[model samples]
Target: MTGTGAALTYTTIAGRHRHEIEVRRSRFIAVLERVESQEQADALLAALRREFHDARHHCSAILIGANREVQRANDDGEPSGTAGAPMLEALTRRETADGRTDLSDVAAVVVRYFGGILLGAGGLVRAYSGSVSQALDTAQYVQRERCGVFQVSAPHATAGRLENDLRGAGLTVRGTTYQPSQVLITVAVADSSAELEVFRERLAGMTAGAADAAHVGCEWVDRV
Candidate 1:
């Protein structure tokens, strides 16, 4: 709930990532995964609990929704504020490659195996925070961008070159469909009038007004 306005883009993990660290002889296994809703986040936590059944603590945090409007955490028997809170901070504070701290749709769980020594409150916070940070370091990142979909129809002879030109102009070419008479190229642009206008103008210039692009709605696209 920290940010307002329509969500245009955000960063998230590409898939599950696991990283383990040892502090004061205790093993902290951190698992980070992409979750789109509360149910998915809960499911991930439940699966981890079952997989690491013998672990001493299964602390977890989840940041779901486009603007990270849903944030939840659980100490799971660990000292208050020592495990889950720090883990959540790691996800919210992570910066994408473009330097945006807008990571969302992520769930993090730290499964701790006791090593016979008790870490102080400060030590525990550092351990959990470091575990998640390390896991993020090794995770593959992707950006979820809101884009307007467009279908551009062109002559079959010019489709290949047109596709390359679109990609070269920094547009996302989702795919191309072949037909007996023409080619249908699907492309995505930022979901804004200004972006769409630019795309149309570019298409006109690229095809000498021979090709036409039709707006085909919008959706969230994943970009690595």
Candidate 2:
């Protein structure tokens, strides 16, 4: 119910989303997968290459990083800029909730099965771009959030009641674990100083100083 730490979120493919289309006798199969780093993207490309080895061409484009900062595209023997460029544009220009059109952390691969046809440069561009666009229709996105995680400990008898009370207070309790002498409660909130302060005070009052919170760490987590 407070500041979100000026943290930002980006849009990306939910998981592995696929779509296929035939154009001018050429079959284009597009597969989209979410990836967090260059290594992951490379692995996907390698896997797809082996999976669609029989196809005429296996083109791909990868965009990763919070800023969608990294980009790589390969035409894979197609006309220069015909296959990979258009596909890159299709995925790179996606708009986020805050109006940033730079989509991040998505790997898209297009496999072409030639049907004894020669689609010119223009046609190839359309086919590749269209492949990714169609797959995006059914794609789901997991929003990455910058969250603050903290821990608190309480006596075993009061831990359950404390968790319930924390949840009732509109807190996002990440998890709770039991120990021999006490219980450990972990909670997360928007990454912000204000939110952390609020959490500390709320826990103090709820347990009458019996519960004290400790800052764990911060990272991006998926949210539906």
Candidate 3:
């Protein structure tokens, strides 16, 4: 439990959320959506542009990867750093209502309907950042953590009890499968090697060494 797995927790919006604000007669509509990949982010931006073709600018930003290692932003014709940069900053700085921080796998697009009152570069920055912050206020999210995966095999009679014990021991049972002579249980666990060793001991004690789990892979799992 001493690596990134123990140190980082990512925040992700659960679905599409939006906020609209009027500043000096200009309308800024911010749309925030959870996107798993760059392609999806671009597609969503394209759709928003077409959907709001009447808008003057479609400023956008995308944060991808579990660690948010991938990020892309575009002013989309707004002055450099005035629109997209602020929007991205607002997202990266703010946290969800549930308190998760460092938002990732998110795409934010702000469609501006110019009010004819030029909101100079400074004003644009404030408007865009505020627009995203407002949308985040109404968004729902779950915290995500990376976990190692394992598959445990057990006799049919011992499977149910083992599963209950696993859950009781704070392991995430991904799924279960029944075979002709045994049952397979997939579990996702945190990164503590000590905890893993303890789990093996628990398995031995529960089934008298007749059942055990095999390390498989890893994935990002979400929880409230």
Best by lDDT: 1
**lDDT of model number 2:** 0.84
Model 1 TM-score relative to the real fold: 0.84
Candidate 3 pairs with clashing backbones: none
The stretch of ten residues in a row with the least summed lDDT in candidate 1 is 1-10
Per-residue lDDT over 182-205 for candidate 2, one digit per residue giving the tens place of the 0 to 100 score:
899998876766877887888889
Please report, as a residue range, the 10-residue window in candidate 2 with the lowest summed lDDT: 1-10
lDDT of each: 0.91, 0.84, 0.87
* Per-model TM-score versus the true fold: 0.84, 0.86, 0.88
lDDT (Cα, 0-100) at 102 in candidate 3 = 72
User: 1-224 in candidate 3: lDDT tens per residue?
Assistant: 33554444577888899899999999999999999999999999999989999998999998888777888889999999999999999888886646656788999999999998998989999999999999988888877877778899988887898999888877789999999988999988765687678878887887788877788888888863
Off by over 4 Å in 2: 1-7, 98-102
Return the clash pairs for model 1, or none. none
Q: Higher TM-score: candidate 1 or 2?
A: 2
Question: Could you give candidate 1's per-residue lDDT for residues 1-224 as a string of tens digits?
Answer: 11348788888898899999999899999999998988888898899989999998999999987778999988999989999999999889999877889999899999999999989999999999999999999999888888888899988888999999999999999999999999999998988778888999999999998888888888888974
After superposing candidate 3 on the true structure, give the runs of residues whose Cα lies further than 4 Å from its correct spot: 1-8, 96-101
What lDDT is obtained when candidate 3 is compared to the true structure?
0.87
The clash count for each model shown is 0, 1, 0
